[model samples]
Target: MELKGKIAVITGASSGIGALTAHLLGQRGAIPVLLARSEDKLRAAAERITGEYGLYRCDVSNSGEVEETIAKIIAKYGRIDILLNNAGFGRFADFIEMPVEEFGEMMNVNYMGVVRCTKAAVPHMLERGRGQIVNVASMAGKIGTARSAAYTASKHAVLGFTNALRQELRYSGITVSAVNPGPIETEFFKLADPSGDYIKNVGGFMMTPQYVAERIVKLIEKDKEELDLPRLAAAGIRLYGLFPRLADKLTYKMLNRK
Candidate 1:
């Protein structure tokens, strides 16, 4: 799992954790393939990377596009050593008030997007008999959060998917890891809440994208199955798992009251 000169494909590489990770991976000598819906942002990110980098404008939500794009990458590079399923989106709304299409969008991007990209890359990895897959989940994946029903469900599925992939590929010389990050200051927050209230309340504990990127590189090198950033948040997630009802009550009181 050495990153040096490895061929890595990172989805949602336009900004946030994906963009930072592309830079970090390039610095580590990995050839990064940047995939995102935004050609402008992808170009900028690829330009910033020092090593070999490719920019592909494709939405992860589109199965055909993802399949075609990954095929092109493999055809060009001859092998994919790392596949990072990091493309996702979030929508915060009461479950009852959330639109059906919004739920579909969340599932499509956060859950199915991972599925599509993984499906495209796994065959190549199996043929090569070696690869690493990293799914960027969230703290919400570990526990339900207020006004994030769809987002939480998508992330939970991501955790489940990564776990399954890890078990299935245990003897295949391929590694599957899930990086569960707490709140990080990124464009995702703005998409979740443009008003800045969510920022004011949750922003205090938010980690920078570069910090998460550093951890991702470490996980790739160590072949760790899961990496949780910010020790306090990891502790909170474990506690929430132990006391779901109490955690729900506290979260509702803290986030819903505002």
Candidate 2:
């Protein structure tokens, strides 16, 4: 889809991939509607966009906030040509040791946040019969790793939802795509792995948020179905799927990196 003059709504736009994508979209003449929980950060992020952009303080985890924010966008912008579901977080902990509340929080913000935003915005897109939904999932969605069971499960739900939604909207002029990035240099690590071991272990393999953001912009322009960052890791995921037992034996040390 041509991004020129398009209306793109990006969740989690306070920073990282979401913020970078907003800037890229604005450069292409798209009206980026940036949403995030922090109004101050959103304000700062909006200033970074090349052209005019919309800023809304929204907590995606709250259904009411998400619905209200989308309504405001439609009322102000008239239509949503693109929806980028990038609002999510992760906490790396063993399932048994993880707090029950943390698990629930992951599902609420990471998985249900996508569901709520899509539900609120799709009807508007359906009215126009043209839109794109790009979900920012993770490589963890494709493979299980240690100390991130809750995070993995949430992203898995996102991929499942993205695939099914794509099939359902196959002929509706609404493209659904998923982005699975392995690791990135972002503030996410501050929250996901506070001790920083995970980032340290995977530092060499991490992609910059700029790189991932550029790929996402291209994905939307090309109308692709899904993307797995750092192609080598994508290859690893494929091998793991093909030979789970062998992969488990060979990657035991790496799997414990978290």
Candidate 3:
């Protein structure tokens, strides 16, 4: 869909990919409606956009907050042209060491947050007969790894939900897609890892948020279902899925290498 003058509501708009997407969309003439838990940061991010935008303080994990904020957006704007479910966080730790409650917290914010916002916004989109939905999942969602039990599981659920949602919306005017990317240069790691080991070791090379946002802008413009960045890495994942035993050997060699 053309982004020019479109009414786009983005969750997690206070920082990272969501914030970057809002800036780019504004440059392309779309009215970005920013939603996040922090009002201060959300306002700061919205101000950077080149045009007038909407800012709604919302915690996507809270059902009442998501419901109320979305209702407010519709009450004022009348319709939503695009919905970007980008609000999420990660907690990386050995599965055995991580508390079980952490899993619930992670899933509530990462996976169910998308469900809550989508459930609230989709009705208006349906009434309008045209809309776009983009869920920012992760490469972790596509494949599992060590030190990311809660995070990987939450993202996996996101991928599953997005895929199924696409099929359910097939006959409708609304479009659904997922953006899965490897690690990016962001504060997410400091929160997820904290000890600096994962970022130092497993994180490897990182993609700039601006670069990923550019690709996502293209994805929104075109009718694409799934987008995974860093073509080489995505290709490797595909290969690994096809040959798990060989992929395991290669992964072991790469990880063990000095």
In terms of lDDT, the best-performing candidate is 2
lDDT of 1 by residue, 45-137 (tens): 777899788989999999899989998998899999999999998978888999999988998999999999999999999998999999999
TM-score of each: 0.95, 0.97, 0.95
- Candidate 3 lDDT over 96-190, as tens digits, reads 89999999999999999999999998888888888989999998887677778789899999999999999998888999999999888877877
Residue pairs in clash, model 3: none
Candidates 1 and 3 compared: the better one by lDDT is 1
lDDT for each of the candidates? 0.89, 0.93, 0.88
Q: Please write out the lDDT profile of model 2 over residues 1-258, one tens digit for every residue.
A: 889999999999999999999999999999999999999999988888987799999998888988999999999989999999999999998888998999999999999999999999999989899999999999999888888899999999999999999999999999999999999999999999999888889888989999999999999999999999889988998899999889989988876699
- Model 1 lDDT on a 0 to 1 scale: 0.89
Best TM-score among the predictions, by candidate number:
2
Give candidate 3 regions above 4 Å deviation: 202-204, 253-258
- Those runs of model 1 whose alpha carbons end farther than 4 Å from true positions after fitting are 250-258
Note each model's CA RMSD in angstroms. Answer: 1.5, 1.0, 1.8
lDDT of 2 at 195: 99
Worst 10 residues of 1 by lDDT: 249-258
User: What's the residue-level lDDT of 36 in candidate 2?
Assistant: 94
* Model 1: number of backbone collisions: 0
Deviation in angstroms for 248 in model 2?
Answer: 2.3
State the TM-score for model 3.
Answer: 0.95
